[model samples]
Target: MARDGLAAHYQGEDIAERILSALRAAQGADARVTAEVLAPLDHFHGRGLAATTEMAARLDPQADDRILDIGSGIGGPARWLAERFGCHVTGLDLMPSFCRAAEALNAAVGLSARVRILQGSALDLPFPAASFDHAYSQNVLMNIADKARFFTEAFRVLKPGGLFAVSCVGAGPGGEPFYPVPWASTPAESFLATPEETRRLVLDAGFDLVRFEDRTEAMLPARRRMLEEVERDGLPALGWHVFMGAERSLELVANTVRSDLAGRLTTLELLARRPG
Candidate 1:
């Protein structure tokens, strides 16, 4: 049911081809393709690539690590990590279109050898036990109704000493968030857990929590700056709006920021290690 909701929310056709056309237009048809050029279009969460940068710092990936990207959309961060750290990345997305698009983008960036894309559910990750050295997901948990299963699957796929990092939107202290947020339209499609419940689920999943922070305060300045940038420059020619729809994308971003400020929504950054 949750998967169906997410698929419905993110469903699109020919996402890869459209993004390729965007890239070609932006950088010229024959120009070199890189994750740097694609970041704006493929970074589909709050604060865009900046959030990925901070997550990467926390992840501290090594050159040869086998990293799993949960809910990797079009392989942006997967390619980025593979490019920046020379690591092998396998990305899983619930939407087949996203997985297909990820493959096409990986091919475009010449990271096909390092980044693999698969279509699967986070609740039941298709990989075998101890399949990954490290793993992470960004802004992908809110759509999920089963937080415990998500963490358990993450734990199962990771090596004993593997670490799983995540950045998620948590339910805030106030009442419900506004409708038409990024993850869902009405309350039926969204499943936001409070910070306390989020932590407890991770612990129950057998991961020793290394760090957990409500990054709402930290994200405020960046969030505001982004709104200003949008007001000043409007939407960029190249962005995820191609898939998410321009007006809807803009509204969702602005609404997310508004909810954050209103204490209706908060972001959480977490790091947990499967006990060695």
Candidate 2:
């Protein structure tokens, strides 16, 4: 998909306002805005905040570290990291709406000083070489067609020995995934690579692999439960559906689980380091 087309896929009007309204409704109108309070609603990927928590553990950020959050939707993980680790986080994404929402939410949670939001592409990071101590991306690779450039740019921006933790949905052996998944509405917007290709791209980018896991089997049970819950009671009040639209979001999430169960989708978690 073209850059504009890709941006359009995730675009929404009054995104920040809508999310804030939902938050206030879920909690009390005067409830204090904090990262933990926003946890259930802000993380826009599969498994939500739990996935971000796991990725942070792998990155092992220090209080003084400068971290990059590639494809940070609404700055959930970035704010969470900044609050928990006292690290500085720069969140980059392709959608202008998302960047605006991220910045607004950062201020809402009193994390504007610690978290910065930028609207940009993963394939072309707007930074100097060796700029950050570590980097991470979650569920963002499926939209990027040039996987090589994505990995290469990440490698370029990280300081030597900096860790990069990435978790994404890869192509499974069982044909193609069902359409209308969370990341894409159709195959035109989705660009999934096999596990072998993903590993090769990371290695080719000069990153020494620290850990790589095919988490498909390990995560299937949880995914099934999520699907069942959605089917049983519909989406919760405070969730990604607030911005993505409840009905469309339901279709997207259901197809994701269907694809996974049918072996058309696979999840991967990778930890790599720029060699010293």
Candidate 3:
């Protein structure tokens, strides 16, 4: 029963309220994003962002480089990259509201001059060839059905010798199916590719796979710790209000653990070169 629609309910005040309430509940009274404008849920996302930044830094782009963030959500990762690496960032996402909020948050953080978001899909980015020095994404590939097209677009925007680093949830060796993210009924409309399949797709799309790491093992222990912490404190008491009211959140976590234990879902990172 995976829901195939674009989780687009996250528009306008109603969706904003739900997100804010969830943030307030999980973050206690002092979340970073203001209650008026829903910001990217950073507590749950920062660790991954940090990991991506570390990986991208290893690429060693020049200080004045421009980077693209595919499927950037609320611009947290983009801002993180800008602040940490002194790079100008442009974020693209299919959600207009997300783009607006991302811009607003960038302005609020006084990063508007360096970080920005545009309403665009990964399938068709509005950019000229060789526009970016580096491109990176996190947790986005699982939702994109067309891996070939996704990599094609990523390759299209990047300059020669540019680096592309991505982290995503993918099917394990068995090639399992999808379920909705926690608290939502049904599964995601998209399919998660196997690690080998993903690597082949990237290579096919003309990227030189510099490094590919299957971190499914690392994610297992991390999720177990998160579950233990959440169980000790109630959902509201825990710092995960972002997914609040989605009773299925716990279910999703359980399923993720099950999949990881069974080697079905993996957290993998891929580093590729656009070929100078």
Candidate 4:
């Protein structure tokens, strides 16, 4: 499987422990490990917490909704949704460590009962057809070369009228993004699609588009502020770097910013609904 090797790339001993240590360092050991405290670090995307917050609003999940989070990462967005909307969330990721970390964090936030973490691939979702009321993914499509399968599985998993919202970095017109970006270390491992192609694939998978927006301009302001902070203050004492390892993460982060600025990548926010 193209995604099987990713588990090693993301794996680190004591992932849950490392995250807890970082949280303690940043917010004091006595502080509660609430979703609010984990928000910044949990969101592993371009705009971080801000992006997740916006995506959640677009989803507008109902209290009894069954939400599916594809490539859920460390379950940050899923946990947030479950807590915020009183929804039941199932989070699936390729990395076992990520699943473990997600479960631990969910437990920490008292969401263990609401959120279920599964280790799996987006191309072949393990859930039954028409199982979920809503599905979403963030920055996960870039790694999936079989765009059709990815979209098809999401579509199949959704109940009629279910919504699938996503935010992703698409292939750009100018050139190619620098290697070791957040999703992949090399070009072969990344399978970015143009925004138009992404839309076509989703439609081909039988979804009706509700909205699609080029969100780069909105994301740029937040990204710029982050870059400025990095230049002035350097990295913070407590963050994902603890797990990603400071040395490699710095370069990957810089490359992502450079690639985004060079027009080699574009950010998009899209919403699609399963036709009843």
Q: Write the per-residue lDDT of candidate 2 for residues 43-157, one digit (tens) a residue.
A: 9988898889988988989997999999998888999999999999999998888999899989888899999999988988999999999999999999989999999999999
Alpha carbon deviation, residue 144, candidate 3 (Å): 1.0
> What is the TM-score of each predicted model, taking all chains together?
0.94, 0.98, 0.81, 0.95
Q: Which 10-residue span in candidate 2 carries the lowest summed lDDT?
A: 1-10
Q: What is the lDDT of candidate 3?
A: 0.69
- Give the Cα error of residue 265 in candidate 4, in Å: 0.6
Please report the TM-score between candidate 4 and the true structure: 0.95
**Candidate 3 lDDT tens digits, 1-276:** 332255532323333345556666766767665312232353223244457557666666566689998988667677766776678999998767667767776775678888878888898889998999999877778767788999999999999999999887777775563354431234445567878899999999999999999888777777777667656753443323343334555555556666666776777887999999
Sorted on TM-score, highest at the top, how do the candidates line up? 2, 4, 1, 3
TM-score of 2: 0.98
Cα-based lDDT at residue 254, candidate 1: 76
After superposing candidate 1 on the true structure, give the runs of residues whose Cα lies further than 4 Å from its correct spot: none
Residue pairs in candidate 4 whose N, alpha carbon or C atoms collide under 3 angstroms? none
* Alpha carbon lDDT of each predicted model: 0.88, 0.91, 0.69, 0.85
lDDT of each residue in 1-276, candidate 4, tens digit only: 455545545666677778888888877879788776787777777777787888888889889799999999888888888888999999999888888899999999999999999988898899889999999999999888899999999999999999999889999886889888878877767888888999999899999999999866666666677767776777777656667777787877778877777778889889999999
Candidate 3 root-mean-square deviation in Å: 4.1
- Which scores greater on TM-score, model 3 or model 4? 4
Better by TM-score, candidate 4 or 2:
2
Residue 162, candidate 3: alpha-carbon lDDT: 93
lDDT of 1 by residue, 89-174 (tens): 99998888889889988988899999999888888898999999999998889988888899999999999999999999989997
